[model samples]
Target: MGSINYDDSDVLDVLIIGAGISGINAAYRLHDELPDKKYLILENREQLGGTWDLFKYPGIRSDSDLHTFGYAFKEWTGADIAEGKEILTYLKKVAADNGIEERIRYKTRVNSADWSTEERCWFVSTEQDGQQKQYRSRFLYTCTGYYDYDAALKADIPGIQNFKGKVVHPQFWDLKEDDYRGKRVAVIGSGATAITLIPSMAEVTKDITLVQRSPTYILSLEKYDPIAKVLRAVLPQKMAAFVIRQKNIARIYASYHIFRTFPGVAKKILGRLTSMQLPKDIPLDPHFKPNYNPWDQRLCICPDGDFYKTLREGKAHIATGHIDQVTNNEIILKNGERIPCDIIVTATGLKLHVGGKIATSVDKKLIKASERFVWKGCMIEGLPNYALSIGYTNASWTLGSDCTAQYVVRMIKHMDKYHKSMVVPEPSNRDQLEEGPLLDLTSTYVKKAEKDLPKAATTGPWRMRTNYWYDLVQAKYGGYDELVFQ
Candidate 1:
């Protein structure tokens, strides 16, 4: 791929941060829809694919099916719950085929961006290969995910420091360097990471234990979708992919709504399904039953019922209780049970960090995102010509992000047609607007970082977004009368 020439004098139309799934989608949209616009993707890492490239944990896969998670422009016929490597490969292929790969500048870390009212452009400072560099752009779009890549949320288990065995966080796991063969492994936390690790490491380790304070709602999904297979065999490839994607999208949207609308019924349905997978000896009262209602937090997905199968086979076990402490060779629980293990995998959670900690300012005045509101769940209030991609918590991330990319493109096109240089969201009714969280998730990581993210509204364009169908329609045809375009 050809490299983008660094020229401080040349002002690009857009400067996108991160080469993750969102950034790639943004680049594709800009190139395909607005071909005349010059944009560049700045990735701090040496490779693209963001999370897919960053996490090398065993049995790492998408919780959401790939049909919805995959790009709308691209058709994915692979397994619904795609593995990490396959997802990375798909991302690379999308970038390559679309000519977006050449426009990406790897190892370029953006530090700060300041908007100049007088110049009507942004001056961005970055560090590449230890050399400070500068660039100018008319608009800035952040696709860096809402998590701190440099650090994982620390596990709070008491006496963890005193444990004389190998301790690992899934975020930083090395399959080759960290060996777990024939050793007893204790995975802490009941989230997606913990469940994924249990099934993947079960065959290698003598026994893997899932140690959690409480149970998380787990759902079993078929690895391969028969509907997709039947459609592919009958319809054309592209048409089949499109239909399958939409079907999955509707399925998830309906499921989420059903779960939220009828919590008791949803719980019973999930419980019955889970009971069929687990062995009768292991009851569903404490270990499998979650105290909270369904969809209170994102449900953990086990592909092909592997998580339960591993448990039924006696290779994986679950222990639900508060951890009292960790001895040199055992994890002591509050219930007076000791779990002997050689390795402790902390699949605790992520630490949310938005905008990659890029210091943003307007006219030399510092802009704090936490103090502002999100406009249309894409742009920040009072921030000119800026957009950020945040995906849906209830469905595939790409569905939300793809809409965001489309929305940004629409905004840019509107600006171009109207000959406007800057566009920012400033509602005249800001004072009367009710404040809410941009992310609706109740997960520990989200709650911990609630104060650090942009606030959401209860109504209008500034309202919190969850439904992709609504967002898709809004992104294409939503009114921008509330925005101040100049």
Candidate 2:
């Protein structure tokens, strides 16, 4: 790729990519802590709130509770569980309230970022509309997330082209033109998208057939206040926020520990609860069962028993079997059953990629991300002045991102104090240690990026722990002194 035009008018202290929650929070922290330093937020989209703005599907609500998701300094005064639009609105408000909206450059996509050892800065190339521009910054932070915005997985079944009806993917939903009202639809996947979309679309569509190879463990929750409301009213905002966050974090961690320590006992308790919600005739054996324990993958959460209620009402049906092939207007199952539909929605998971196609190079030599071990899943070992904001698969993405961002700010502050130009994580024994894949084998993103990416250490949180509290203890407060900076 040719180099973009250089216009180095303003040399920034930090250049953040993707103005989503992570990037925004990072900017906020940097500005708050070090107001003298200059920073810029470059976003690919016309608007902020990366994932929230990208996904406009029906019933697009948060999987986790909102209190933990929002900023620690700013209290989430809205409802407990916020919808997609509400979240987007809140993000915009945050930018506006902080007076950082003007600092963001919209519709500008970063092509590549290269680090120079001599200058100790990053050369960032970005394209806006049809024009290209370049800049240099002391620090670089990526919050692009793992998935591709424009791409969605298409079903690989034979004769998919022969289908006469309109096919859609939730990732690429058309806001105008097409409608699913009063039409028979078949949604594929057992992930969060499929779980949330199936029951919701069933309300408008004539019938919805949920096709899945296996089952996902679903839990029901309600947006109500018995004690939280009383506490919030009685106590101060900061105090209330701290109390609620602590309580929720403890509860979630304890439950997860129980599930991990005693699988059989946890399964029995969870299985009984799930059985009580669903129909007795529905097979709970292998279909609704998982090979791994709960929280291994992510457990799908729903508000109330909407998913089960939809199934019981006969408006929606869950087909737990392998999809053999696509035959014109129907899907043929491996068990010799044909389910006909007018519209097919493939909510089949997302593809995960690190840095969102932004290549990293050191001294003109291309550095493969998969070849490096992640330091707290943010900084790559041996890379200078760069950090990534990736989220937890089990917990809310913002929770992990926020903690990591704070640590990065602190590190930067320390660098400023010591008069250090760059900070890199260099391993002591690069030859003795071997690297492994960053994610589990079952994750679609890991499978896709396995060949080209940096290999993270197989052990520790860099390889495993998806819990927020655990990551907080380890990354934020535990190993700070040990982290080397040069």
The lDDT values for all models are 0.90, 0.77
Please give, for residues 1-486, the per-residue lDDT of candidate 2 as tens digits.
Answer: 111232345778889998888888887887777777778889999999988999978878788777777887777776666788988888888888776687788999899888998998999998988799997899998888777776765457667788998887888886332478888889888878887887778778888888888787787766643466877989998898888877766766687778778988987887887888777667677657776677666778777777888887888887878888897899998998788998888887776667878878988788878677787778887678998887766566788888778778878887888899888877665666556665544545456657765566655434544667666666556564325666
- Cα lDDT of model 1 by residue, 324-428, tens digit: 999999899999988999999999999998889899999989999999988878999989999989998888888888888999999899988999999988988
Candidate 2 weakest ten by summed lDDT: 1-10
- C-alpha lDDT (0 to 100) for residue 241 of candidate 1: 91
Cα error of candidate 1 at position 434, Å: 1.3
Off by over 4 Å in 1: 1-9, 175-178
Pairs with steric clashes in candidate 1? none
The CA-based lDDT of model 2 is what? 0.77
Clashing pairs in 2: 369-454, 370-453, 370-454, 370-455, 371-454, 382-425
